[model samples]
Target: MTLLSMYFLAGVLAVSALAVDFAYLLSARNQLQVAADAAAHAALYYREQHDAEDAKVKAVAIANHSMPEDSYGAVLRAEDIEFGHWDYDSQTFTVDDFSKDAVRVRPGRTETRGNPVAAHLFAILNKPMWDMTAQAVFVVFDPHCLREGFVGDKVVDIQSNNGYEKGFCVHSNQYVSVNSNNTFEAGTVVSMPDSDEIELPRSGFESNAGLQAALRNGYYRLRILNQMDRIYEDLYWASGDFLPDYIASAVPITVSQKKLTNADLIPERVHRVNCGGQALQIEAGTLLHRVVVVTDCAIRFGAGVILDEAVIITQSTDAKSINSASDLQIGRDDACADGGGAQIITYGGLEVPAALKFFGGQVIAKGNVSFSADAGGIEGASVIAGGTISGTSNMTMGYCGTGMDDNFTVPYFRLAF
Candidate 1:
């Protein structure tokens, strides 16, 4: 009986050891997995705001924080982090030197030398060490050109009964509301990143193949738009020696009286064009050659206002209207090589007449941009607005597709699968 009791006691000790050791190992594995997941997510977000190397560093740091040194038998290291893309078909990951879309992280592993988790009880069974490894993968998503046409940062309201034509990408940052009777052409996609307040007809707003093809193939990204201030100055505006230091502070120059003289333009200073809070009206058939500036005042382009590679900027604090901005022959004869295209930047809303027609140019504005059907619509033009972009009557405009560098970039990064 004494011998039997001693054997029973030995068996009890082994069971207790197994229970404790197994629980510890399970808990440690869960912790490592959590760390890996966290690291992958952080890496993707960091890649969005910065370059690739920085993103890897960010991921490693986040993973290390989750599984601190000595928290487990092994420590998370930078070598455990990897950048790559995933193959969904094969369910595999391939490392790449140039890809910023995917990030992989391994929190803790016995693969590292001198870093094996020591088993407290399992050693009695000729197993003194255990290896633990956990991994996670995350991918990033980006949009292409045919995916955008009218992108508003705040609000978008379209009540046009005539509908939208093909080859136009419409995306908004806030909400998109399309009223009744407004149809859509083939290859036309209307997307909003923030709210799901999209109101459009499902069964063919216009009943065309082009519009339907766009809807079937295109995708949407719900995120904040990237800033385009630098692109506006560098790509769209005058560059190199033609780039000015600053336009001096001067009263508004008007062809209202006569053609602008040399006194109207300040040579060698191109960055600043200052109109001292006064309205500027370019008389009918007047020719403009340099960048023009206006501050909190109306800008009226009279009949046949011809621009010889000119750019105009109007900034306003109050809500004032831009009167009779019509009948302009801008950047047509020069072939748009000097600056690629004539440009217009406005801070306030534009109230244009029916005869508005712009050729080979672009408009970047902070307020609503509206065009009328009384005259011809835009041709080879890219118009960007901070608010609504609409026209009261049905009009035709050809924006088909511009260079990606031409559009304002709103960098949005997100996890893909």
Candidate 2:
């Protein structure tokens, strides 16, 4: 062959060799891209489950699955792929310079680039293996999402009986306002606004016997005097050292009454009580200590369960504190600071199986607060209710009142794919 012809042939052969290498690089890039995608998805899944180590292992496994495994060096070559976090602004990834010989995966710093498959296709003429790195990101699912199915009432009214205190007292971390025509008393020694406005109906003192009878007869209208009023009420009467003559001429009147019953205070454990097959009954004076964790459980009371402490009811557990004559009090405990010290945290919704009779006490519902019964079933006696009622699609209500019409401003998480 002539010298010119020989030179032309050599040029053609060089071009052909470049094309072959380019095709091989393209195939490798495509495989790497597949590996990266699989690794990223796997890592994300693991993070959602709160398992970081497992996530890494799964990611590696996915990378291996997407890599070639026919040759003796196939497994080793696939292991060269690295996975990590990519910082966009930093313009880098967890793995700065990964290669078939150096397969070290970096933590908290992964570089993100155009698809690995595209990179391989472009690496035909120069550069070793392209930058084929994988990254994963995940966010936790907020428990708040579980609160999206609550429905209930807001305003409640409790009438006063002879000398019985009317209305109720409420303490909340959120805003609370009273609109009912009743008296509100701060049960504790600490004086609160509007305490004086809430007083007994006739005598302005609690008629224990009459109140008991009313409760038993299902007539929650009987009012009791707000004894705590002495600290706040200016009209309180105190007759002491009556003139000697007037005291001597007075006749003694016979007064008989039944003793008040103390509630069963159960400490930090789960208890199953009957709600008269109505909803779930928690008799008055019932105390739950510690956190009462429940699962798909319902607590219905004949009168209502007086929660002197915090009660947490999750989706796995359903809790209902329904009373006929008194308000369902939650988060009241001696350990509680200035407030009633009781907290009712619900991951699920609250159902007032009957008319809620709010005699007294505050409610802090983190979930939805709902009333299903009519006046006959539920009545808003002298009660102060507040808390967020969340139900579906970022929807929330009454984060601070008895009604489910307010919005919640608490921080929450969102689960994603």
Candidate 3:
């Protein structure tokens, strides 16, 4: 009986030792995985602006910070950081040094780096040590609705006879309300947080069969709106160099008295026009090209005013920060083509009453945007508003996949794997 008791004690000791070794191995692997995840995220974030080498350096530092070299023994190397593109369909990462979309990181403790986790009692089972490698892939993505469309934080109300072209999108964080006789072309999307929350006519779904496609889950938050102040500061300071060519006026620049012509903008493509809380109205038949007008007052585009390759910025919070009459052209070329596009960035709302032909350009507002004119030449033009988008009718808007770099884009990072 005493010899049997001794044998039972020996079995219990062996089991306890195995448990300790398994727990230690798991803890080490978890630590390595945490370091890899953090490093991948850091690398992708820095890669947005820096080169590949700089990104890799940042990743290695992050990994080391999480798991010190003394403890982990150089778990991460600069070469272990790879720049790549994460394909959603194939769930694969293709290495590309030029692409800044994704980053892959490998952090590990292994025999190769002389950091293999030594085992205690597992050596009795011919397992002297354990090796672990943790890999992480981080990617940046942009929502399609924000790229080229009419996106509103509040309601998006459109009247009848309006035709949205292919690739065009309209999304509202709250809800989207539309009247009948509107055409939503194939490949066009109108999305809200909830499809049942969309306000439409009685035959809304039947009339617009494409409305079914609009029933997508989740709402896209406009992160760019929060960064507008920073964006404004950058544009404002960059215009300081060409201050001498500013519109020389303390009062408003109106058509009745002081009208502005192309001659007012000279030598440079950017200019600062401070109206001292007054209005800045361009004269009729004036053609401004490749110029940026930064002002603190409201802006008015006179009849037949062609703003080709131009940008108008207003810092006013007035109800109508930007207004235009009939025959106001914003771009000079095709919507999908590059170059010769105009943009209007307003702190308040934008109101275009009639015959506003805009192409290959973008209108971004901190307030509501009302376009009552026909949507001729609206392809490649994005109308984004912080508030509601109403008073629109008989307009057609299409998406321009390329040549829209000027459009405000907010990129977000996610762990793909």
Candidate 4:
């Protein structure tokens, strides 16, 4: 062949070799990216359960699937070309030791290089291999969604189990109106804010006219229609007994006069505190130093958890202070001595197991406060015996404050994932 013809042929061959190498690199890069993406998605599924091991296995499996394979001889064949040293596990070039053709699949990150293709005419020019690399990162997916309201209807239901009547004392700055037609029985008391003209269900009251007149004149009526509607919707979601099985099965609870020395005042598993006996479970516990704070905890009563001190406060704010005359604060007190600030005083729910005898003190329920027992038989923390829970024409119950109101906010659940 002529010298000029030879040179031309060599140039054409080199160009073709470059094209093949470039195509293989591109294909390999695409595959690597796909593998990385799939691996990341799979890792997210086990992020909360398995962590790193699960993620690594899933990534390798995905990478293997992305590569092309053949049967029998199992040669790396693609585009009518036979490639050598395509070791996926090592992700390195088989032909050239220093070649850029390699894939490194690591936990969290995967790196890959294009296939190794020998140059035809370029081989004479000392060009043996073309190298290409791609990298991909894995991340967990996160999304935010808000949940609100109670799980079901009937936020509060007062029933007579042993021929005893029940009642509630609802105190609120807003108007109180019953929306249900359920009977208030013969001795139910409903209170409200103002003595204004109000309507009542005929079946709920024998003295419908008297009840309306009292409500109009700011006299908290003994019976209001559908009073359960005024309760915060979240109150219904709380888990625990509103009344204890028996009044005498309560355990005594004591608080020291000095500040609490430990972060965990009660056992971790003690989710509920029941006082169901004649004696008050929580007696004359002094708050001379920092106040007793119950956090991430529950104070349940059997039937007779009495409060020796009427000055007890259930403070809901982070500062932990009594806001009103009837307010009682529970949870950690950051201001108290030796306050580690480690105490988690946030309770998801609160239940009154039985009639709570409160001499004084505010019951501040940061979460939901449920009262499902009969009103007349037992004297609850707020309700008196046979007094009939009388509220003004506009009495309110449940969490009535602003910002994430009880009716609008739902309890947060601890998901496994």
Candidate 5:
């Protein structure tokens, strides 16, 4: 009877040990999974800033510190890191040397026989260890680039007197008002939250509040602009992710910005910059690779003003004037001519010609983007207004993908499933 009791006690002790060891293994796995997630995101961010080789180096470095030195009882090595694409259809990760969009990482590589979680009491029964693993995948996307052609928080009014070309997409969170005299080209989309309220000129609404997630959330891991004015500061640095190709891909301009005091820049200069976010006059037929930042000031355009390879940012908080009005004034109605497009951003209200044409740059304002007269609207341009885009007549916005090295795109990163 005493021998039987001893055997029962031994069996109970072994079972308890096994349970304790299993808990430890689970904790280790959770730790590894967290490390891999952080590492994968860091790798993708690095890839955008630098080359692929530098990206891999950064991924491994971040993974090594995510878990404690003895958390998993093994140091993370470079072999565990992988550069690849996350397949949407197969729900798998595929290795690729030239992969740019996605990154994959495995902190505790337990696929092989040797890299297993060492067991405690289970080992006494010849079940010495068990395999444990965790992995993470991350992908990169440009929020500003990979989205609808026209986006408005309140209302998206497509009251063009002319017609919409193919491949045009318009989105609004609140409402979409399509006034009269508008023709919907084949494959044009008008997305809004309340699909029933959508006013279509010819056909039915092609898209709806699918963009609600993007509008409400900033999911990208890097280069996000929460405020409307943040876009201006980012133009100075490539890390901010909105620098035009003209400046980023150029041979490093000795000067990126110039200071101007309500005076027009000389058009003939090759690459002159206007800094200090001061107000300036962009005369008609002005051509140069320059950057203009306007702060707490107003900008007037002499009729027929043209900006080539240029950036214009207006930063005004609340109201710059005593009368509660925006300090920025764009172009006059009769005196209008433009080409080679410009990048424009304003924190206050903006007033422009009713009929406009821009060869593709960014135009964002905190206040209303109103028109002066009925005219042919924008072509190859992105117009974003915090308030209403009040205008009528014909307008054509051809989505020009990264044209003339002057294209600017906002980027972000996040875990992809």
Candidate 6:
């Protein structure tokens, strides 16, 4: 009976030891997963501005920082980091040396790496040592609104005689209200939270061709204006200004007393103007090229003003933060020129001119956007507003993917494993 009790005690101790080893294995796996996730995210971010080789180096550094080599012994190797494209529909990742869309990181504490997790009970039982690896796939994507379209947070109300070109997208967080005699070309997308929630006239379907077929139901509640602060801060720092109020306290930029012209601005330098609650009115035929203008007041453009490779930002919340009277051209010509486009970011509403032409340009407003006249011609035109997008008769716009480099795109990251 005493020998039987001793055998039972030995069995119990063996089971307890196995259980402890299992728990330790789980803890080690969690640590490796954390390190891999961090490494993948850091690599993807670095790949935005660098090549795959540089990105791999960055990943190894980040992984080693999380798991020291002396303790974990090379959990993540530079060769194990891969740049690739992740297909959402297929749920697969394909390796691509030149792709910056996704990054895959494999971190392990395995026998091959000479750091296999020790298993005392398993070794005593004549079992294999613990060999584990953690995989992380991090991806980056741009929002549809920034891709090329008109996105309104509140409502999108369009009047009669409006024409949208191919690939032109219109989305509203709430609803879209449209009047009669409108044409939405093929490949155009009009989206909202609910397709049935769109407001239309009695003969909406019959009056507008492709309107019924173009309606899509989706939800995108991106706070796009929040990005303006980062852009503003970046421009401020790039201008070599240490103080936030340095540009705010400076004198107003003018050419002839109250007016501004080509001579008033230097294309190579960043110009900051303190309007002091007044307007910064540009003279007629003023050609602003390769410059950045940051101001706190409204901007009024004279007739026939042109912008090429330029950026105009206003922090005003007035009714017309950026207003044009006669006409405004946003590029060098009809064909898109490399490094020749313009972008306008305003905190208030945008009052578009009679003929708003765009070879490649973007208008981002924190408030509403009122198109008083026709806006067509060329390509690469995007209008994003936080409020409503109303007014307009006979409006047309195009999308040029490569020509929109001057425009800003919102980026986001996610971890998929």
RMSD over all Cα atoms, model 6: 7.3
Across 142-233, the per-residue lDDT of candidate 1 in tens digits comes to 36432235555655565555456666556656656655555566666666653345555554345333433344222334232123344334
Off by over 4 Å in 3: 1-35, 49-79, 82-99, 112-124, 239-259, 333-335, 408-410, 414-417
The candidate maximizing TM-score is: 3
Instruction: Write model 5 residue lDDT over 33-59, tens digit each, in one string.
Output: 888888888888788758777887787
Give the per-residue lDDT of model 4 (tens digit) for 37-95.
55434433333334344444554555446543321111111111111233546644343
Error of 5 at 129 (Å): 3.3
TM-scores across all candidates? 0.58, 0.36, 0.78, 0.27, 0.59, 0.70
* Candidate 4 minimal-lDDT segment of 10 residues: 143-152
Q: In candidate 6, where is summed lDDT lowest over 10 consecutive residues? A: 240-249
Model 4 residue 182 lDDT?
31
The number of clashing residue pairs in each candidate reads: 14, 66, 0, 58, 16, 1
Q: Pick the candidate with the highest lDDT.
A: 6
Model 3 lDDT per residue over 1-417, tens place: 999999999999899989988998998889899999999999998887688999999999999999989987999999899998989899999999998899899887889998988887899999888889999999998777877787899999876778777788888899988888777778888888987888989887777656677556558767777766765765566532222232233232322223467777642344667777678878788888766667777888898888776777778988799998887787775646776667788989989888777667778899999876556657676778899998467666666787666555657788999
- Alpha-carbon runs more than 4 Å astray in model 1: 1-59, 64-110, 113-147, 161-163, 173-175, 179-181, 193-269, 280-315, 320-324, 328-343, 355-363, 373-376, 379-384, 397-399, 402-404
Residue 198 error, candidate 1, Å: 4.6
* TM-score of candidate 4 to 2 decimals: 0.27
Quality of model 3 by C-alpha lDDT: 0.78
Which pairs in model 6 have colliding backbones?
A: 161-394
Best-first order by lDDT: 6, 3, 1, 5, 2, 4
Go through the candidates in order and give each one's C-alpha lDDT. Answer: 0.57, 0.32, 0.78, 0.29, 0.55, 0.79
Off by over 4 Å in 5: 1-39, 42-102, 109-128, 132-135, 143-148, 160-162, 192-224, 227-280, 283-295, 318-341, 371-377, 386-388, 402-405, 414-417
What local lDDT does model 2 show for residue 81?
Answer: 35
